[model samples]
Target chain A: MSYALSTLWFERQRYLPAVLAVAFSCLLIALQCGLLLGLFSITSIPIDESSADIWVAHPDVPSVDLGIPIPEAWQSYLAVPEIAHTEPYIEGFAYWKKPTGGTELVLIIGARLGPDSIGAIRQLTPELRMLLSETSSAVIDEGEFTRLGIEKVGDTAEILGKRVRIVGTVSGLRSLAGPYLFCSLDTARKFLNPPPGQCTFILGKCHDKEDAPKVVERLKAHPRKLYPFTTQDFSFHSQMHWLTKTKAGIALGLAAALGLLVGAVVTSQTLYSATVASLKEYAVLRALGIPRWRMAMMVVSQAFWVGIAGIAFAIPTIFGIAFVGAEVGAKIMLPYWLLIFATSITLVMAMLSGLFALRSLRMVEPVTLLR
Target chain B: MRADGLPLTPSMKAWGLTRSYGSGDTKTYALRNVSLEIYPGQIALLMGPSGSGKSTLLAVLSGLLHPDAGTVLTLDKDLWAMNERQREAFRLEHFGFIFQGYNLFPALTAREQLEMILKWGTGCSARDATARTSDVLTMLGMSKKAHLRPMQLSGGEKQRVAIGRALIKQPNFVFADEPTAALDWKQGQHVIELLRAAAHDQGSTILVVAHDARIIPFVDRVLHLEDGILYEGEERPMELYGGPTAPSPGYIAQ
Candidate 1:
């Protein structure tokens, strides 16, 4: 065995606590970070699904959820030669009444009448589209059916205390804000009682996909009170908007931060104990003319091995939990960045723990071996 | 090259050394103004009743403990006068040690124990250390059991491995504190013979802190400690040790 590894092998059994701490830290950090990321991912879900090339919102809006309605006259934006068309959309929180007399929180998205464009309802069959054109017909996310106590399509559910029939199901769209309820503009206006020709903001498409950036740039400098962003930028801004502006966003972020802190503390403590337990052996190394820093490095190497094992154990576990989270509609998103981030944090924590644990090393007098 | 090509310097020397514990009336002397010299290429036994300062003298002469007063030198380099780091380096460079309990790392196999020592010695590479480890373990009769960790080794085997570690470095001095205290008379005699062989082969001096009389025959000189005082006593002739008489070992003059 190589020197560091050989030495670590001898001390391997004793470092279980440290390794376990790192594993648990990985789990905690990944879970919290995954939650925050999952939350952030969905924060932009509506914009991404809508597939609009550009979005116009009031300058003061922080997030998509909090944006003030831009004037409907902004429809003049479509006159720009590069502009394809525009769809006005609306979204708001709704009290989804269950058949059992319990109410669930849901966000509703109104796909204002236009092309098959500018809405999260990616594919609406002609029959479903014809059905959604009516004021009383809407599609519910299938994931929400369990919570609404409805078993199949054509079931009646209540929105805003009004009986509404679930005419279809929108697949593959979920929100950290819970399942979304989608409908036509007429239905949303009838249900939400908003003024005619006034919607939250205009969703604009470019004539060519490549024209989107130029349109966004030109529209940004356009003489309008409205703020213009590419749909991608708008989605990004919306996520950031909620992340910084709302209590839920802050809570999710705080939860992630708390996970990191707990992981660090627990891992550090375990590593420190492991180091102290090996002081006698380290002292022998010290006596053998190993410099203090080299001895410190021995502790680091031990922690590194433990950290490696912990990552091996943790990454799969996080992915598995994320997979399960998908089924339950609770977002646990472990992207590549989060995996790298959590692993880096855990390794650093283990190393710092080893360094902190070296405090007891000074007492390991080689002469003590004689005693 | 005489390991440096100089007139022989004493392996270790100490004069007017004093070390004690506690303070005021509680300050009991462990070694009181002890003066001593051990020379090259011989096993020198330190014998004394319990608490007669044998351990303290070993510690002081080996640079494990600092003396309150007086100078101690190993290989003509002043040990007590060096800074703490320098003294530690001096000890690592010049001495090998064995403790009463064997003091072997439980996780290390017998070969590793010796290799680790050799690796730490000045100018030794891993390859060279491994080679030296093989040689020394064989010399100490531990080659067959070199793969066994300390927990698997017998008490006598552990002691031999510790001896191997000390010998593998070819140090200027080997200090074995009660090296054979855990062994039977035959094993103890065998261990002493190994120490003697190392001295003869490497020209390194050996200082054994022990009370066993059976080991007396194998040593070149004997020092007795009493109430913190140390003094040289008569050496056993080679006949007494079942061999032809040989010249007595020389020492550096005080």
Candidate 2:
């Protein structure tokens, strides 16, 4: 074996407690961040899934939680010379009859199946177009189906007192605020109501993304008297609205911050304790002519092992929790970048603790070996 | 006569070495103006009572502890003038220490312990390091127990392993602090013989701070210490008879 590997192996048994602590701490942090990311994903599903480059809503629609009515004819108005396509979208919550003959709440979304349909919900599945074409068809996510005790694909669900046949299942496509049910505009209008010309919002797609802001400004100035926004602006406003107005969103943010802080402190303390415990060994090494930098490398190596082991132990458990959370109608999305960021944070915390432990190492006098 | 002078070549010399602990009225003088010389190829013992500065002198001589006021020259190099880093490297390159407790690294086997010294000494490849370790273990008659860790070995075996560590590096000098204190009479005699042979055959200077009378007979000269001053004694030849010798009456009195 190489010198480093051999020495590390000899010292490995003494560092078991520190390693276990690191693993458990990493697991805690990963699960916390994963669940939080999952929650954020659920809340932003409509915005994330929408194909619209611009959105037109009421001047103060607030968030996905609130709905504002606009003229459905605005779709034709937005389909101008510069605009490629436009569609009117209906979004609202309604009670649906469960497969078990009970009732559950879900967010209902309406969009046409055509060249101007925008395909926001269709992004959830390839079969969405086929399902929406059925006129009486509706698509519900797996999380909603599982919670409502619905197993078979053809099961019928009663929304707003009208029965709609389930034509397909969409996975991980639930709305941030509630379980989502996607259907044709006709079915949505029939259930949600004031006839053919009324809709909740207008979604417009442009030929060039750079033209989105100009298009939104033009639509806002139209005599139809509507509030319009670029998709990015609308998404940002939606997130901010939820963050400031909803108790669940605020609580989740607080919990995530607290979890990060506690994780850092706990990991640092554990690593520092391990260093102190091994102070004598470090002194012996110093007396044997090992430099301070080599001693630091050994400590850093220990920290690295801890961080890696902790992340490894945590990943599966986070996925399992996310699956369960999804079933309960909470959107738990695990983003790749977020996982990488959390691992980096864990390494930084471990290194910080190592710095503290180095103080104890420096205090060791080689002459103590004589005593 | 120049204190067994024979034209001292200053292989290891201390001048006006003094070390004191505490301050002012409460001060304790561990060593006061102590000076001595140990020539190469000599096994010298520092004999003293408790608190007589034997350990302090050894610490200074080995570059482990700096003296309050003195210059310790080993092979004409001033020890105290070197910085901590330099002193540590110097000690590793030129000095080998064997303490009373054997101080063997608990995680290492007998062979590994000796190999650690050789690796540091020669910076050689593993194959060469192993060869040197085996050679040294054979010389110390510890080849059979080379695979055993300190915890698995008897006190005598552990001390023998320590001797192997000290001698494996082939340093210019070796400092031993009560090396045979933990061993029985036969084992103690064996350790003293090993030290004597290391000096005679390897031409290395050996200095030991010991109160054990069992080791006195094996030393080439015993320097008696009353307070911290060295009082030179007559040179004595080592008596390596087979059986255990009874403890000295003076030690029994203490």
State the lDDT of candidate 2 residue by residue for B4-116, as single tens digits. Answer: 85564647877788888889999877776767778888888888778867788788888888889988888888999999888878877778778776766666689987776
* Model 2, runs deviating above 4 Å: A1-14, A44-108, A114-281, A315-338, B1-8, B111-131, B141-147, B234-254
Clashing pairs in 1: none
Q: Compute the lDDT for candidate 2.
A: 0.72
Among all windows of 10 consecutive residues in model 1 chain A, the one with the lowest summed lDDT is: A113-122
Q: On a 0 to 1 DockQ scale, where is model 1? A: 0.28
Q: TM-score of model 2 relative to the true fold? A: 0.69
DockQ of each: 0.28, 0.20
Q: How does model 1 score by TM-score?
A: 0.79
Compose the digit string of candidate 1's lDDT tens values, residues A42-90: 7777777777888888788777665566667887875688887787887
Question: In angstroms, how far off is A214's CA in candidate 2?
Answer: 22
Candidate 1: TM-score, chain B only = 0.86
| Deviation in Å, model 2, residue A108 alpha carbon | 6.0
| Model 1 lDDT, residue A79, Cα | 67
